[model samples]
Target: SGCDTQTVVNNNGSTEYGLFQINNKIWCRDNHIPHSRDICGISCDKFLDDDLTDDIMCVKKILDNV
Candidate 1:
């Protein structure tokens, strides 16, 4: 499916830019920001502590829905 639109998120009032939306019970894209910045939360890595910051990549998110 193609992306509709994007929304920016200021994580904890920081410069973390992320795109996402919660609609129809679905949490859409996040930050749409460059992978170099912001930690995306699309998946749960039970193996990790999930202390990822906003400046990280949520590669799991992309893979999960794809």
Candidate 2:
């Protein structure tokens, strides 16, 4: 029998049960995210996280937490 689980926090400040650890890391699918139009003042999570949405408004949520 194989069993594994952990706690993961989302941008909304919610905890999700994480399982199937891969060398102390959990993998999940990322959604579409939009980046800032201006590259100078753009503060999207693109540099840190992938684009989860094609719209800035949608990405804002992830950016807020991430």
Candidate 3:
């Protein structure tokens, strides 16, 4: 079930992105979309980078909440 940073999957009508496969409907937001929790407090684009610094931070937040 693992995927790379550039991997994108369609879940019903929603989108999941990046290595962590973060869901756009909950963890990240699209500019024109609404009701996104965005609990990571970051843009979805940030997770698409290879650096992984911000991605790790956001993953920590997700883990902390679990």
Candidates' TM-scores?
0.18, 0.22, 0.78
Error of 1 at 6 (Å): 20
Residue range 10-59, candidate 1, lDDT tens digits: 45322222332222112222334233222233422211332434213443
- Write candidate 3's Cα lDDT for 1-66 as tens digits: 275786465746666768888877778777634778998877888777787888888888889988
Alpha-carbon deviation at 60 in model 3, angstroms: 0.6
Alpha carbon lDDT at 18, candidate 2: 26
For this target, which candidate reaches the highest TM-score against the unseen true structure? 3
TM-score of 1: 0.18
The positional error of residue 5 in candidate 2, measured at the CA in angstroms, is 1.0
**How does residue 55 of candidate 1 score in lDDT?**
16
lDDT over C-alpha atoms for residue 17 of model 2 = 30
RMSD of 1: 12.6
Top lDDT hit: 3
Query: Model 2 segments beyond 4 Å from truth?
Result: 1-4, 20-66
Error of 3 at 47 (Å): 1.0
What value does the lDDT take at residue 23 in candidate 2?
Answer: 15
Which residue pairs collide in model 3, if any?
none
The alpha-carbon deviation from the true structure for residue 50 of candidate 2, after best TM-score superposition, in angstroms, is: 32
